[model samples]
Target: MEKPSPSRRAFLGLSAASLAGLSGCLGSLSTETDETPGGNTSDTDPNDGNETDSDNETHEEPTEPPGLPEGGAVMFVYDDGPMEDYTQALPAHRTFDAPATVGIVSEWIGREDYQSSGCMDIEHLEELVDAGWEIASHTSEHTTLGTFELVEDAAPGAERIYPEEIRHGYHRGKTIELTSDEHTFTRAVADYGSDDTGGYIAVDEPIEEACLAGETIIRYPAEKIREAMGDSKHALEGMGFEVETLLAPYDNFDDYSRKFASEYYSGVANARHGKRVNDPEGFDPYRTRRDYFIEYTDRESVKRDLDEIAERGALGVLGAHTFKEEVTEDRIRETLSWVDEREITVMTLREAIARYADR
Candidate 1:
């Protein structure tokens, strides 16, 4: 079976593509409309209801909207941190003098499978940093944080392990990690099933019969979430990169994950697929948005997405994968060409996030 790519979902409201589908998604371009739920970016402080600055006085909101570098800002973000980026994607971006933020799976770096699968190694990631591309953590192994239905032991002090650190079991003879708390488990019970909607889940009682069923854990607990975040950030920092951003694998994260991310990352790239266009002046530093780029996405779709960003003066964050069969050189070149024609400014995630400081 072919491998699966990331799924699309909304961040705070409708996705950018879905918003585009709406009759008046961009009607009047009113900055007054708060698209994100409970996100009042006007006079409200992002930190909390306490809008007072350090001086114990109210901070004034900027009268003018924040501006992009030139025409507009278009940020291309590549996921899974594939090595082909060094050989292929990077060259294409350099062709247009564009910059991108590559989400790195820290565990995949220098691994045998990563090497064979064309995932980028540490040196390649370093080279990307040298070349001015921003490197963000795509989690330690691109592990989806909260998508598992693990059979657990209800007994206190049961065998517990971090979800991302899980290393055993098989779903239909495939190695399954991030699921049930199966410390000694090498294979799932007979009822393991996966489908188009749900990725993988236990479908029968056989899994429970094998052991006293514990509370079903979703994503990593708070501690484990912290460990994973710290591990990935440290791993990249060990490679000499000033890491401060995280791109959640599959763009999936729980509230706990977001909390821990703020401790380690300056910003996290967690957003809806089509609704990634964000205005820097009204930027949310923690819950940054992003868009997806698949092989099937046509040039018109790309142009339309960029055009939406340009028109709104929002920072368009486009995402892609390097090692997939669909991520071809020609496609990358084509996307770069679109960005070039639009005169969009290409910057790393760090550079983009810095604008929020002045805002």
Candidate 2:
């Protein structure tokens, strides 16, 4: 099946004739909108009252709340913490401004999958935390929690491991998606090896179950993500990190997913498909995006995305992963240098969340 791209009807997906038109009309004025629920951006906050508010409650056409933060905003959420993020990308973030949060997959932190085990070291994370980079949970494993049903034994402080499900090709099943039997969301921390503290949970542990406990924000690939985030907050705390924001898997969150995470993060939610619009010849850090500038996330497409945001008065967020050899490091550097030269705020995902709260 040809899955639709995030930017359907965008420049990237436009037909040859339409694309030519778009290219010609791509002057200073053109607009596009992506209001789809699953194009990687969603509101999954937990409604914890802290993260979410009915700020736009007025009946005046219910526009975005005024007195909010400036220009709404832009931010960066680095997902998965691949080593490249640490070695190749972080310095750029630092040069611009400290990032707000760095979501990490606990299981992949020190382990290698396909030899791309995260390049970030524990020390690097520690340093980042010291440098004001808020650390948040990206799940113990990079599993799509929503799709993977919790077994009976799942419980708090008790980590449980599901058998490998079939992967993409050749029917290598890794998990089986199903509805929750109990139908209540909760957290499980299998008390891995040591109940002492800061220890890894193992596969075999008493499965303790509860209604999805944790902080509100979450990101799972299943249909009902709220339930999957159950009690995940405390579970993450047990791992020695104060759990706050929960970025979506692949940065993919729909409105529901965003509602869940907002319960805790209580700020603007992060999305994968933010836009980038800067000077074509040069770049204004205020209006530029490294991912977009590097041509990694489709710059022209992003410019159009920006136009939509400007019209809607809604917040816009842009995420970036490491630019691989495929995209070329030189391009990445050029984008970063532009941000620094322009002195853009270059806020981190967490910072944006906090700012959104103020907004």
Candidate 3:
């Protein structure tokens, strides 16, 4: 089930303080670690990179894509932890001997009636966690980690979310201004580490008026997404759920995002547009340690990704919003067929964590 909720303000304050300490050592923070892939989950690095490593140097080791055990090892993961996720996604997991993990927006569990939309319900959520799907954090709300990609993902001009009015001229009616999701989020992210100079807010709150005056792709809103991360970690752990994976809200990430995703969650899954911005594994865009980007778009694609999982020897994560209109009930069923094929071992994020930890 759910654990006692922490005070949001308190958690935010603490997280900022912690991040600050990291910034102090930021100069020497980027030093390379002896992190290596393969060798089971044992090789999974725990850096979540939550701390500031700006000063340390980074080194990339030449590694072949990781391959799974003999046949192939795959882990299925779902995001948002919504009730529909519990209702629709979990059954497929059970049929296949595969365990799953669902990341959640702590605050969105039950406020279904909120003016601003939220995520799942508590009872069904409890049922899923009790049944074995790993429950991880997606922040207090479904906020993006760092600035989101403004170019293709989001439409230009003031990303409008709600369309209500508050005596301030139709909150977002008839006016699509050019803005980034830098601070905008369904749920805000917990800005961890010691840097507290910038508090959290909507993706485009910290006005760079001069720079962002005209039409320009908005920046990813990492600050709000990372708010209360420490408290969130505590909450998840307290709920008897291990903090294991992170889903970049809409796969919105950047250099700093990768660092924290590595530091806080065991793995992170983002959309693989297949476009290498700088380099796939570069600071701007990198290989996700948690699992492979999902390919559950179709049954054939599912099979292809599964084969790739085996070929890579890395984990293949199955992701869905349960809310996506595109991923229908039928497609979900078709996707699970591959999980049952026995070619891959199905596991939850927690199970993956345990397996890796054991290794």
Q: What is the TM-score of each candidate against the true structure?
A: 0.64, 0.48, 0.54
Model 1: per-residue Cα lDDT over 64-135, one tens digit each = 222245456767788887677887898987787666788887888766566346577777877777666788
lDDT-wise, the better of 1 and 3 is 1
Model 2 over residues 141-195: C-alpha lDDT tens digits? 5545322222233345544333222111111222222224344333323222323
Window of ten residues with lowest summed lDDT in model 1: 1-10
Clashes of 2: 63
RMSD of 3: 15.0
RMSD of 2: 17.8
lDDT agreement with native, every candidate: 0.59, 0.42, 0.45
Report the alpha-carbon TM-score of model 3 versus the true structure: 0.54
Across 1-359, the per-residue lDDT of candidate 3 in tens digits comes to 01112331222222222433433434232323212221222222467725335556444433221112444455555766655675567675555544566777776667676332445675667777666556767765455444322222223342222211111111222112324334322322222222132211233333233223232333333443345354566666766655655655555555656656655665554534332111111221134343223343345555676776655544555566666655455666666665455355555544333233212
Stretches off by above 4 angstroms in model 3 are: 1-68, 114-119, 148-209, 212-225, 271-286, 289-296, 311-314, 326-330, 353-359
Kindly report which residue stretches of model 2 are placed more than 4 angstroms away from their true locations once superposed: 1-72, 98-100, 114-119, 145-236, 255-296, 299-315, 327-330, 340-343
* Cα misplacement distance, residue 185 of candidate 2 (Å): 16
